[model samples]
Target: MAERHLEIEQKYDAAADFVLPELDGLPGVASAGEPEVHELHASYFDTADLRLAAHGITLRRRRGGTDAGWHLKMPAGTDSKQEMRAPLGRPLVVPARLAGLVAAYTRGAELRPVATLETRRTVVRLLAADGAELAEVADDLVTGCGPDAEPERWREIEVELKGGTPELLKAAGKRLRKVGAKKGKSSSKLGRLLGEAVVPAQAAAARAAARSRIAAATSNGKGPGITTGEVVLAYLAEQVEAIATYDPKARLEEEDAVHKMRVAVRRTRSALRSYRPVLDAERTVPLGPELRWLAAVLGEVRDLEVLRMRFAEAPAFVVEDLEKREKAAYRRMNASLREPRYFKLLDELDRLILDPPLAGAADRKARKELPLLVTRAWDRMAKDYASIKSADDPDVARHETRKAAKRARYAAELAVPVLGVAAKRVVKDAKRIQEVLGGYQDGVIAMEHLGTAAKRTKVPAEAFALGVLYGKEQCEALAARDHLSTTWSQTLGPSF
Candidate 1:
C-alpha cells in the first residue's frame, strides 16, 4: 500500500567542523535523546533535461534508515512538502503508482537517475516534558555524484519536526546560528548538485521577459502593462497550475477533487475558445476535444457523486444502487488515469504553455481589448438566456445557457485584474446565473437517474422511492426555471 504524509522541516548549512548544539534549552524541547548514526543512500530521478527539478518536484529511491522506499515529494509551502511513499522494489525502478502522480510534471518524459547522495546521518531526537519526541535533528556528512559530475562532499543540518511547532524550529535555528550555521544554499542535495544549470531554456526566457516588462512599467510610473497574450496566457497558466495542484487530491479521492479538476479543464477550454483572436486557432482549437474528453470521463463519476448525495434520504436499496454505480464509475475514472491518452493530453498542455501560438492580436495591450472580449461573452450569455422560451421544456436551452454563463464567468474573471470593479461585479452576477442554470440541469440529470434506477430495481418499495425522488427533482427543476428570468435580468442590469 502507498502511504502519504507531510514532511515539514528546516535545513541549515553547517561547516564540516561544526559541532552539535544543545537542544534541551530550545522552546518546547525538554531534553535530547542519545545520537544514533546511520548511513543513507538516495538516488534522485528526473528527466534527462531535469523537468521535474525545474518544477520543484523530486522523485527518489532510498535504501537506508527506517523510512526506506520510493519517495515522491511535492512542494507544499515555504518549509513543508507532501511526500508519497511506496515500498522499494528489488530491481530498483520508479514505481508505477508514484510515476502516475508526476505525469503532469514529467509529461511522460523519460526519468533517469540524475544524482545520488550518500549521507552519514547523526540523528538526535528532541523530547518534550512528558518524554514524547517532538522532533529529530540530523547532522549529515554528504557525498553527491551524478552521471557527468565528479563526486562532491558537503555537510548540512536538517531539523525535521515530528510533533513540534514551528516555534521549536525557530528556537533551534537560533542555537545553530550562534555556532556559525547558515541557511542551506539549496533546499536539497540534488538541488546543490545540479546547481543553476537545470533551468529549462523556456523558463529562463520567461523570467527575463517578465523582468524587462516590469522594468519598463516601473519607468512609466504604472504597474506592469499586460498584453492580450499575457492576459490569456495568465488565465491559461492558472488553469494549468490548477490541474497540477489538484492531481494529488484527485488521486487521493478527496472531496470535490473530481469536480475541481473538471472545472479546470472546462475553464482552459473556455479560455482557448473565447480568446481565439489572440491565440492561434490552428494550434489551440484541436485541444478542445481532448479537454472535453477528459472532462466527460471525469463527469461520469462526478455526476454520480452528486446524485448519491442528493438522494441520501431515499430508500436504502436506491441508495445502495447509487453506491454501486458510483463505485463502478470511479473504477472507470481511475482506470482512465492510467491510459496513454490522458498522459498525452498532459504533454500537449505542457507544450501549449511553453510555446504558445500567439497571433498579432495577442500583442495588443489588455486594457484595449479585454473589456471588449468580456462584453462579448456577457452579451452572448444574455442572448442564450433570452432564447429560452417559457413554454419550452427548457432542459436543452437551460444547459446551453449554463455553458454560456460559465464562459462569461471565466472571461469576466480573467478581466478582473485589468478591468477592476466592473469585471468583478460581472463575475458576481454571472456566477448566480450559472448556479441557477446548473441546478436546473442537475435536476434534469437526477430525474433521469431515478428513471434508470426504477427500471433496474425488482423491488416495489425501491421503485416507489425512486418515484418520490423523481418528483422532488422535478419540483426543484421547476423552481430553478421559475427564477431564471429574474436572475438573468439581475445579472445584466449593470453594464460591463
Candidate 2:
C-alpha cells in the first residue's frame, strides 16, 4: 500500500530568467519551448502547530494543476523530497496510509486548511548535449491570496535537477546565488504561499507533551505514572520513522536493511510487552501475537542474512576435517546450516510482516485514547537483567541474559533518537551484553548437538572430538562471562 515518486520541479522568479540561452542545443520545444502554464491554486492542510513541517513533511490539496489532488511531500534528505499524490475521491479525503504517516507527528490532532495560494507559471526544459531534455524548470509568479484581499505577488526560480547530485546543485546554485537565486526561503510551495498563517502556532507547544510523556514513561510505577499512551506513542513514532528511513534502503535492496526495519517492528511489540501495564492489553493484547506473526514474515531474508554472516565467519578448519577430531564438530554445523528447517524459518518470517493481525491497533489515530504504560517497563528492564543474572541454570541464564540485553537495547534505541548521547551509551552497553550472552548460547547449543550425535554414532573417535569441542565451548563461555563482567562494570557501573 506504500507508494513513492521521485518528483523534479523547479520554480523561477520570471519567465525571462527561466529562458537564458546557455547551450548550443536544448530540449522540449527545441527553439522556443511551450510557454503554456496552468494557473495553480492549492489549500495547505497542517496541524495548528504545523507538525508536518517540523517532520520535514508537507501535505496539501491542490486544484488547477495538471495533477490535482492530495499531495504529501516526504523528506528526501536535504534540498529534496519525495512527493506522493493520492487522487481526490467524491469525499475528497486523505489516503489512509498518507494520513497514518502524518498521524505519527500530529499525534492526537486535527488537520485543517490554514491558507491558500495561486501561481502563474511558465515551464522550460533542461537539455543534454544532444538536445535531449534532462529536467524541467518552472517559472512562477506566486500571488499570495486568501485570508487577505490585498494579495501580493513575488518572483522565484524552481529547478528539479535531473540525474544530478546535490553537489551539481551546489555549483548551479552558486551561479544562481550570485544573481540572488539563493535557497528558497520556504521549505515548500505551500509554506511560501501561506507562511504567515501556519508556522508560529505549530512551534510553541512543540514537543512539550511528547517530552512529558517520555519522561513520565521513564519514571513510571515508582509513584509517578507512565502512561501506555507514552510507550505506544513512542513505539509508533519510531516505527513511522523506520518506515520513512528504510524506504530508500528497501528500494536499493541494501543488505540487512529490510531485516533492520523489521526489527523496529519487534521493538514496537517488545515495548508493548515491557510496558504492558499502560495499554489495554486486552485491546493491545492481540498485538503481541500479531507482531510474532509479522516477525516471522520478515524472517526469511533476515535468516539468510544471519546464515551468510555465520558462514562467512565459520572457519573451514572447524568443519568436515576427517583426520582431525574437530571434523565431526564442523560437519554438524555445516549440515545444520544447509537444512530445510532454515528455509522454513525464513518463510515464516516473511508472511507475518507482510500481513500482520493489526486488530489490536485499529485505526488508532482518531477519537481513540490510551493510558501510559511507561514506569513499569523501565523498572522491568532493570529487574529483568537482575533476574537473568541470578538464574540457577547456566543455560537458561545465558538465554535470559540475551533477552535482557534485547530489552535494554530497545530502551536505549527509543531514548537515543530523542535524548541523544546518554541513550547511546546505554545502547553500547546493552550491545556488549548481547554479544557476550549470544556467543555463549550459540556455543552451548552447538556443543550439545555435536555431543549427542557423536554418542549416537558410538564412534569413540567422534566422541573424543566432540568432548574436545565441548571443553572449548566451556572455556569460551567462561571467557564471555568474564568479559561481560568487565563490560558491565565499565559501562553500567556497580549499580547495574
Candidate 3:
C-alpha cells in the first residue's frame, strides 16, 4: 500500500562553512532544538529521456531516513508536491503502483536509475511557544553522481514545514537569507545532479514571451506581425501541457481532474479542426479522432461524476447503484489510460508541438489569418442554430448547435491574443450559447437515465421515486427549450 502526503518545503544553497542562523526569535518560534545527525542515500529513476524530471516529478528509493521508502513526488502547487510512498522493496525495480501513476509521461518507456545521491545531514527542529514541532531545518552536505558523470559535492539547506503556516515558512526563509543563504537554483537534488539534461529548454520560455508580445501588440491596436504557426502552436502547447498535468490527478481521482483533462482534449481537437487552413491536414486530421476517443473515455467518468452530484438527494439504492457504476466506469477509464493507443496519442501530441506541419497560410501574420478562421467557426454555430429553429425534433439539432458553439468558443479563445476585444466578444457570446444548450442536453440525458433506472428496479417505491425525478427532469428540459430563443437572441451580438 502507498501512503500519500503533501510535501511542502524550501531549499537554499549554502557554502561549506556557512553557519546556521538563530531561529528562536523568528515568528511563532520559541526555541530551536540541538542538531541531530543522519546519513541518507537515495537513488532516482526516470525514463531514458528524463521525461518525469522534465515535468518536475521525482521517483526515488531512499535509505537511512526516518521516512525511508520508494517515493513518487508530483507537482501539486507552488512550493508543494503530492508524494506517494510505498515500502522499500526491490532494490532496482520501480514499484508497480507508483509506475502506473506516471504511465502518461513514460508512455511504456523503461525506467532506469539516472542519478544517485548520498547526504550527511544535521537537523534543527523549530518549536512553537507551546512546544509543538513547527518545522525542521536540515543542513545537508550532498555528494551526487549521474549515470556517466563524476561525483559532485555541494552543501544546501532544506526547511520542511511540519505544523507551521506559510507565514512562518516565509520568516524562516527571510532569516536564512539574512545569513548569506542563496535560494537554490535547481528544484531537487536530482535536478542539480542531471543538470541541463532534465531542465526544460529556453524555447518554452521564448514561446511564452512571444505570446505576451502578440497579446500586447493586439491590445495596442497594432496587428500581431507573427506567423499564424506561432499563435496556433503556442495555444496547442498550452492545452497539451494541461492534458499532461491533469493525467496523474485524474488517475488519483482528484476533484474535477477528469473534466479538466477532457476539456483540454476537446480544445486541442477543436483547434485542429478550426485551424485546418493553417495546419497540414495529413498529419493533423488523424489526431482529431484519437483525441475524440480519449475525450469519450474521460467523459464516461465525468458524466457519472455529475450524476452522482445531481442525485445526491435521491433514494439510497439509486445513489448506491450510481456509485457502483461510477467506480466501474472509473476503472475502465484508468485502464484506457494505460493502453498503448493512449500512449501513442500523447507521443503524437508531443511531436505535433515539437515539429508542427504548417500549411502555406501558417506563414502569414496571425492577426490577418486567424480572424477569418474564427469567423468560420461562428458561421458554423449560426448554421446549426438556424437548423434548430426549423427542426420538428429540436433535441438533436440543439445538441449539434451546442457542439458547434463549443468549437466556436474555443476558436475565439485561441485568437484572443491576436484579435483583442473583437475575439473576446465572440468567446463570450459563444459561451452563453454553449451553456444554455448544454443544460438542455444534460436534462434530456438525465431523464433518459432516470427512466431506465425506473424500469430496472424491482421495488415499487424506488420505481415511483425515479418516475417522479423523471417528470422533474422533463420539466427542466422543456424550460431550457423555451429559454433557447432568448439566449440565442441575446448572444447574437458577436458574429466572429
Candidate 4:
C-alpha cells in the first residue's frame, strides 16, 4: 500500500561558498535544532522521452534518508506536490503501484532509470515555542549523473514544511536569499539533470514560433488577430491536458475524478464535432467514436456513483448493493483506462495538437468563422427543441434535446475566447436548457433503479420504501418535463 500526503516545500540554489543562514528567528520559530548530517542516494525513473518530468512529476527510489522509499510526487499547486510513498521493496524495478499511477503519462513507454543523484546533506529543524517542529531546512551538496551524460555537482537548499504555514515558508526563503541563494533553475533534481530532454526540442521550438506569430498578428491589428484553427487547437490542448491530469485520480477512485475525466473527453469530442469546418474531417472524424467509447466507459462508473448517492437514504441492503455495483463498474473503468485503445486515443490527441490537420477555413479569422459555427450548433439545438415541444412522448425527445443542448453549450464555450459577450450569452442559454433536461433524465433513471430495487427485495417495508421513492422521482420527472417548454421559450427567444 502507498501512503499519500501533500509535500509543500521550496528549493533554492546556492554556491559552494555560501553559508547556511540561521533560522532561529524566522516567523513561528523560537529555535533551530543542531545540524544533522546524512548521505542520500536516489534514482529517478521516467520514459526515454522524460514525459513525467515534462509534466512536473517525479518518481524516485531513495535510501539513507528518514523517508527512504519509493516516492511519486505529482503537481498539486504552486510550491506544493502530492507525494505518494511506498516502502522500499526492490532496488531496480519501479514499484507496481507507482508505475500504475503514472501509466497515463508513460502510455506503455518503458520506464528506466534516467538519472541518479547522491546528496550530502546538513539538516536543521525549526521549532515553535512549544518545541513542535515547524519545518526542516536541508543544505545539500548534490552530484547528479544523467544517462550518457557527465557527472555534475551543485549545492542547493530545501525548506520542507512540517507544521508550518505558507508565510513561514516564505520567511525561510527570504532568509536563504539574504545569504545569496537564488531560486533553483529547475524544480527537481531530475529536471536539472535531464535539462532540455525533459521538454522535446521540436515541441519547444513550435510553441515559440506560435507565440511569435500570434504576437505579430496582434500588433498588425488584423481582424480578431487569430485564426479559427488556433482557437480550436488551444481548446483541444486544454481538454487533452485535463484528461491526463485526472487519469491517475480516476484510477484511484478519488471523489469526482471520473466525472472530470469524462467531461474532458466530452468537451474534446464536442469541439471536434462542432468545429468540423475548421479541422480536417478525414483526420479528426474517426476520433469521435473513439472518444465516445472512452466516455461511455467512464459514464458507466459515474452513473453508478450518482445512483449510490441518490439511494444513500434508502435501506442498508439497497445502499450496499449499489456500492457493490459501483465498485464493479470502477474495476471495469480501471481496466479500460489501461487498454491500448485508450492509449492510442491519447497519442492521437497529442499528435493532433502538435501537427493539427487544418482545413481551408482554418485560416479564416476566428471572430467571423466561429460565430457561424456556433450558430449552426444553436440551429441544431433549436431543431431538437422543436421536436420536444411537438412530440407525443417527450421522454425520448428530451434525451435527444439534452444531448443537443450539451453540444451547443460546448460550441459556445469554445467560441467565448473569440466572440466574447455574444458567445457567452449563447453558452448561458444552452447551459440552462442542458441542466433542465439533464435533471429530467436523471429522475427517469432513478425511478427505474428504485423500481428494480423494490422488486428484488424480500422485505415488505423495504419494498414499500422503494415504492414511495419511485413515486416521488416520477413526479419530479414529470414536473421537469412540464417546465421544459417554458424554459425553451424564454431561452431560445432569438437564435445565435
Candidate 5:
C-alpha cells in the first residue's frame, strides 16, 4: 500500500537551462540530481452524483507509490492538496470510522468509484548548491479509466515542493525550459482528472484584483452578490481541510481535537445558511440535517471536556462554598454525558463516510461559477463594513465587525492556496477582530457561570467571589469593545 500523489512544481527562473531529458553530463555544473522511478496505480472513489465535490475532496485507494494506502485528499488553500492516508483497507467503500471522520462534508452523499488511474513514473531530482535534494521532478506516463468519463493517456513532469520555496521552482525552471521541459499547462492530477470540471478560482481572483475593489463590491461589478460564492467556497474549502487535518488528531484523541473539528463543522453549516442563494440549494438543503447531527455529537464530547477541565480548576474541599457545589454538579452531569451514547457516535460518522446518500446533483463541478461567487461574498462583507461605519453604538459596531470578519475569513480561506500571502494577511487581520469579539463573548458566558455558582452557594464569600468574577468579565468586555474602534479603523478604514 503506497500513499502517493504526484507533486508538480513550476520554477520561475534559474541561472541556466535546467531542462528535462538531460544527457549524462553538463558544463559548469557543481552537481546533478538523481531520479528514481516507481510504478503507481490508484482507484479513486466518489459518488456518481459527485458527493465529494461540494466539500472539495476525492478519496482513493492506491498501490505502488512510495507512500501508499487509503488516501483522502482535501483541498489545501488554493492549488495544493492535503492528502491523508490510512493503511491498506481490509475492504473498500471507506472504513466506517474513516468515513465518519469526514461526515461534515460528505453528509448524506454516497461514496463510489468515479475513476481509476495507472501510471509508470520516472523520477528526476533537482538539488541545491549544497548538493542536497531541492525538489522532486517526476515524469508520469498515465492512463485514466473511469465510468462517467473516457479513458485517456497523458505525460507530465511534476516538481513537488518538498523542502524548498516556490522560488526554487523558478531557479530550477531556468535550466528545464532549455530542454523543452516547460511547466505543464495543468495545475493538478485531480484537475486533469476532472478535465473541464476544474475551476480557476485563483486565476479568477487575479482578474478580480485587477479591477477596483469598490466596483466588485457593488453589483455593478461582474461577480456574484456578497456572502454568495466567496463565503461558500471559503467555508467549503476550510471544512475539507479541517476534516483532513483533524483526522490523525481525532484518531490519536489529542486534546481539544474534537472541539476544533466540530467548530469546522459548524462553520461549514454557517456558510451554507449564510449564503444560500449562490449555490444550488437542491444539493445543499438536504445537507443540513446531517451536518446538525455531526455538530451535536462532537459538541457533546467537547462540552464534557470543557466541564472536566473547569472542575479541575475549582478550589479546595470547603463545603460552605457554592462555587464548589456548582463544580460538583458539573462533574456529576459530565460523567453521565460520556456513556455508550458517545461510543456509537464514532460509528455514525463511519456510516456517513462509507455509505453517503449523495444525489447526482452534488457531482456537478462549480468551478466556472467561482468569480461571481467570490464577488457576491465580497459585496456582503463590504456592506457589512459600511453598516459598521455608520453604527453609533460601540457594541453594535463590534458585532457588525465580527460578521465582516467572517466574510473576509470565508473569502481568504477559499483563496488560501491561490491568494497566497495576500489572503493570509487578510485572514490574519480579520481573525484579530474575531478574537476580540470572541473574548467578549467568553466574558458573557463566564459571568453566567459565576452567577449560577453564586445561587448554589450559602456562603457570602462564595457569592462575593462570583460577583468578583462577573464584574471582572464585564469590565474586560467593555475595554475590549472600546479598543475595537481603533482596531476596526485600522482594519476597515477610519470611515468604519
Candidate 6:
C-alpha cells in the first residue's frame, strides 16, 4: 500500500562551527521537546541521463527515521512537493508500484542508484501553548557518495512543518539567521550532492524558446523550414499537455476539471481527423477511438453535473433521484481513471507528440495547405446542415450536424493564429452553430432524465413540473432549428 502527503518545509545552510539556537521563544513556540537524534541513510535513483532529477522529481529509499520508506517527490509549488510513500522492501531495490507511477517521465529508462547520503540528524520539536506540536527542526551533518566520486561532507538545518503555519516558518528563519544559519543552497540532499539545481533553468528556458518560435511560425505564417505538419503537431502537442495537466485535478474532483480534460481530448481527436492530409491517416486512426473512449467516460459525469445545476429548482424528490445517478456516474469516472488502459493512452499520446507520423504533404507550407483543409471541414458541415434542414427526424440530424460543426470550428481554430481574420470569422460562426445544437442535445438528455425521475419518485407535483420543463425544452429545440438556416448562411458562403 502507498500513501501521499504534501511536504512543506524550508532549509538553511549551517556553518560547521555554528551552535544550535533556542527556538522555544519564537512566535507560537511555548516550549521545546527533548532533542532526539537519528542516523538516516538514503539512496537516490534516476535514469542514466538523470531524467527524473532534471524535472525536479526524486525517487529514494531511506531508513532510520520515523518516516523511513520508499519516497517519490514531485515538484508541487515553489517550496512544496507531493510526497508518495511506500513500505521499505529488499535492500537496494525500488518497489515496482512506485516505479510504475513515474513511468510518464522515466518512460522505459532504467532507474539506477545515482547517489547516497548518510545524515546524522538532531531533531527538536517546537510546541504550542496547548502542547500541540507545531513544527520540527533538524540540524544535520551529511556525507554524500556518488558513482565514482570520493566521499563529501556538508552541514545544514531543515525546518519542516508538522502542524505549523507559514508564519511559524518565517519566525524560525529569523532566529536561525541571527545565529549564523542561512538559507540552504539546494532544495534536496540529492540535489546538493549532485551539485546541480533540481530543475535546470537554462535548459528549460531554451526548450520554451524553441516552442515559442514554432508557435510564432504558424501564427505569422512565416518561418524558414516551417511546414504544415509543424503547425498541426504543435497544436496537438498543446492539447496532449492539457490532458496530462488536468488528470490529477479531475481525479481529485476539482470543479470543471473533467470538462476541460474532455475538451482537450476532443480537440486533439478533431485535429487528427481534420489534418489527415498533413499526417498519415493510417497511423493516427487508432488514436481516435481511444480519445473517444475517454471522452464518453468523462461525459457521463459532466452530463450529470450539468443537469443537477440546470434543474436546481426541481422538486425535492426529483433532485434526490438525480443525486443518486450523479454518485454512480462519479464512481464510473473514478474507475476509468484508475484503469491501466488510461495510462497506456497517456503514454501513446506522449509518444505521438515526441515523434509524429507525417506524410509528404506535411512538409508543404501551411499557408497553402491549411486553408484547403479548413474548406473540406466546412464543406462537410454544410452537407450535414442541409441534411438536417430536410430530414424528417430532425433531432437525429441535428446531433450529426452538431458534431460536424465542432470539427469545422476546431479546424478554423487551428488556422486562426495563421490565417488571421478570415479564419476567426469561421470560428465565430461555427461556434454559434455548435452552441445552438448543444442546447438541443441537452434538452433531449434532460427529457430522458426527467422521465426517469418521474418513474422513480412517482410524485404528482414532480411529474407535473417535469412535463412543463419538457415542453420548454421542446420549444427551445424548435427555436434553434428555426435559426440554423440563417446561422449557416452567414458564413458558409463560397468565400469561406
lDDT of candidates 1 onward, in order: 0.83, 0.55, 0.88, 0.87, 0.56, 0.81
Give the C-alpha lDDT of model 3.
Answer: 0.88
lDDT of 6 by residue, 344-396 (tens): 78777766766678888899887778789988898898898889758999788
Q: Identify the candidate with maximal lDDT.
A: 3
Please give the TM-score that candidate 1 achieves against the real structure. 0.91
C-alpha TM-score for every candidate: 0.91, 0.50, 0.94, 0.94, 0.49, 0.72
User: Candidate 4 residues 351-394, lDDT tens each?
Assistant: 88889899998999887888899989989998988886589887
Candidate 1 lDDT: 0.83
Worst 10 residues of 4 by lDDT: 200-209
Consecutive 10-residue window with the lowest summed lDDT within model 3: 201-210
Task: Give the runs in model 1 whose Cα sits over 4 Å from its true position.
Answer: 200-224, 338-340, 390-393, 493-496
lDDT, candidate 6, equals 0.81
Error of 2 at 353 (Å): 32
In candidate 3, which residue ranges exceed 4 Å CA deviation?
199-223, 493-496
Name the runs in model 5 displaced over 4 angstroms: 1-31, 53-56, 96-98, 101-105, 129-132, 148-150, 182-185, 193-496
5 against 6, candidate with superior lDDT: 6
Quote the lDDT for 291 in model 1: 93
- Better-scoring candidate (TM-score), 1 or 5: 1
